[model samples]
Target: MYYIVGMHIHIVPNRGSRPTILLRESYREGKKVKKRTMANLSHLPMHQVELLRAVFQGADLQPAGLG
Candidate 1:
């Protein structure tokens, strides 16, 4: 049996501006690894970003304005 799970931030380049920050999930499918969008953190505040990081680190979180 085998399985893979992980999360990380993705940077998407923009034409003439800063790249967008996206939270992504990575997993293994058969012999290939794939990534999926989990959230977009470009517009989040620093504190919120920290909270999201905590959530990804297995902390219990409550939905406030993260929608």
Candidate 2:
């Protein structure tokens, strides 16, 4: 069966500290894209970098004014 996934990106800022980031996804069905499971992959080296790269690749980004 096929499923749909929704991606969300969050940016958090703290006073006197560097910003924090969070990436979450919602699955329209039971299935999930293994590569997007953030918790499971957070321990890896340069995890945030990897996550952003994967997110861009997974989501079909388009120009701001395009339909």
Candidate 3:
């Protein structure tokens, strides 16, 4: 799930009504993990929309009713 500051932009993954963020990668102590570039989205006022755009870019992700 993408969170801008604090507001939830994308639903992440929903299970029965609860929203959860599933990370495909994990970090461990003493283990070096490849870190990717993290966009500093906290500075934006309209963060939710910006997060949504980031999540859906170049991907065919749409709501159930939207076509």
Ranking by TM-score: 1, 2, 3
Clashing pairs in 2: none
Model 2 misplaced regions, further than 4 Å: 1-3, 27-37, 40-54, 57-67
Over the stretch 24-47, how does candidate 1's per-residue lDDT look in tens digits? 999988889899998888897767
lDDT of 3: 0.42
Worst 10 residues of 1 by lDDT: 44-53
Q: Which order, best to worst by lDDT?
A: 1, 2, 3
- Models 1 onward score TM values of 0.61, 0.34, 0.22
Highest TM-score among the candidates is held by which one? 1
Worst 10-residue lDDT window for candidate 2 reads 35-44
The lDDT per prediction is 0.82, 0.55, 0.42
Instruction: Name model 3 segments beyond 4 Å from true.
Output: 1-31, 46-50, 53-60, 63-65
